[model samples]
Target: MLAESRFVDLLAQVLPPLEFKLYHLKTHLKKCRKLVFTSKSDKSVDAYATHFFVLSLDGIDLLGLEVYIYESREYTTMFVSKADTTGHYPSDKPPTQMGKVVQQLLRGLIRYYLPLDKPVRVCLFAKAERQYLFLGSAKNPLKHVLSDAQLVKWWASCLDGLKSEFSSIKKCALQIPGASEAAVKSYLPSNPQLPWTVGDIFWEGAPDDPTIAVKRIPRFPDDPKLRFLEFLVAEKRVKKVSRAQFWIELQSRQEFRLGTTVGIFGLEGTVDKHESLEGNHSITQKEARLLREVTLEGDYSTKSSAEYSSNEFASRVPSYAEIDVKGTLTTPVVKRTVETPQVNVLSAGLVRKKQKTQR
Candidate 1:
């Protein structure tokens, strides 16, 4: 994980989670380079992956002209093409605003990579935003401040290092817009769909599946214990809560799975069929809330916190599954099924402690 100040940490926390199918990042970068170099076909960019777009608001006088607007974790590199230039404008000198904004955008790109995760490649799509056009770098010319070739090279180098360190990228798409906003406005929503953009990254007439439209949520190998917890949640042996009911705290013991139920001081039921303490029963909403509260509150004490920290943690957390019944694709009825790995959480911890002591 990157060591960031509270402000940056808050930014990371507030940003929505980005999910991509495994290898989507590597492939996207290659495809983006291809589309830009080839200028051949329209492409569909996965929504889950990060991306960029350029909006030529030249037609809109107040907006003036700007390039390189948005960027995210999966979508890092963007370049305005001379082919998309308009009215024989001096494409070589990017607007001053372009450099300032793009420099900030570059900061974002560097931030995404600093964590040393995978490098993400995104496609460009143009629509509705009106701007002048020119073809080829030499004909229209990107400002020397951040040339198209420079970005390409930077992205290529970043990709080189990232592929060696992590996974391969996926694909890139470019959606070029027509010369006029009136010509393309009908295709796009009145409001912006994404928080960021980098020169119309998607091509026109791309398929829109909205769901599964982007890359798939990243997956890690499952923990056999988490599979069991999912089963318990599904079987209605436990309940879930929407908000914190009380002050709670959680402590992780090597990510081991445990079945727990709890009772608030004033909950309805007092005893179970076996006559165990009300809080200990594997039944009732109170018990579920108690368990979830413990788990969520417990997150603070652990050395690992962010979802991106480690694949091992990601795999294990789900074992104590607690998700809404309605929103999930799998209903409550889906039985948790998996063979538990022989690895013992206790043994893993002891080994880690021993290694630390030796160090």
Candidate 2:
């Protein structure tokens, strides 16, 4: 059919040829013959004739099978078939179905080439999707034999899942401390190789939270006599230091002998310099009790001193006061008086008089 030819062409482009070998059918038949009979006769030959016939027929079929095996510099792969050479003999009809023919070929191959004592690694190539279905051993076989369409669907689903996981990881990496988008992008492969592994999906430090405490032992100890006192003072002043500084200080201070064992004080337990007390000095129980009492008393004294200083500063500032004004509040009132002449009372239009008064 034209459709079949086109499908085969597509397979040729997508799925390259694989490598495989015949099960050496003749030698296995000879071995079987030797085991079955002590003597040979014409009837024995006739009775065993069909087995020989099948062997010869399968040998030709195996040659046709060789066309699918591909070889390259990297590795070899095989394209397994449950059909005949012409791709027509293994019809989906009664008594001559593809499943029966494939089973017969598989049994023959297993019995001859694959010995129970030594396991054979069988790799099958699904042509339609160009994906591999690996079989560890012949004893435990694939549960569901998939058709070409089913294989494509399965491959697509796997790819979708992988993409989703990659996106989630990338998003999470952006939220982690010291992880940059550029760095993640650079570390991730642009085009992943086939037959991927877990290492391909995750990088170093992706699983660890940077905030968690990491316990570390001193690698190289510092000189005992030269830097011991300084190391102790620094350790007392600072709660935490770099791993290198911690190791150096620890080695220097641990050298002093109290009695028989080396006198080791400070820097024993978890050292989180950022969160813990400065110089995280490790002291005996008696010393710790004394230090606690002194700290409490010092805190109380400091609080009292601060309050007294604040009150004294407030008293020193000038206070608000009312002052008396000197000048008069009201202006003096002025009065004016007018006077008329005595003769003007008898005459209607003759006399006039002017007068002025001031207070």
The global C-alpha lDDT for each of the candidates, from Candidate 1 onward, is 0.21, 0.21
Q: List model 1 lDDT by residue over 103-177, tens digit each.
A: 333333333322233233322211111222211212211212223223333222222222222233233211111
Model 1 has an lDDT value of 0.21
Q: Which is the leading candidate under TM-score?
A: 2
lDDT of 2 by residue, 177-234 (tens): 1223353233223453222222111122443323211121111112132144345446
Alpha-carbon deviation at 227 in model 2, angstroms = 62
Worst 10 residues of 1 by lDDT: 344-353
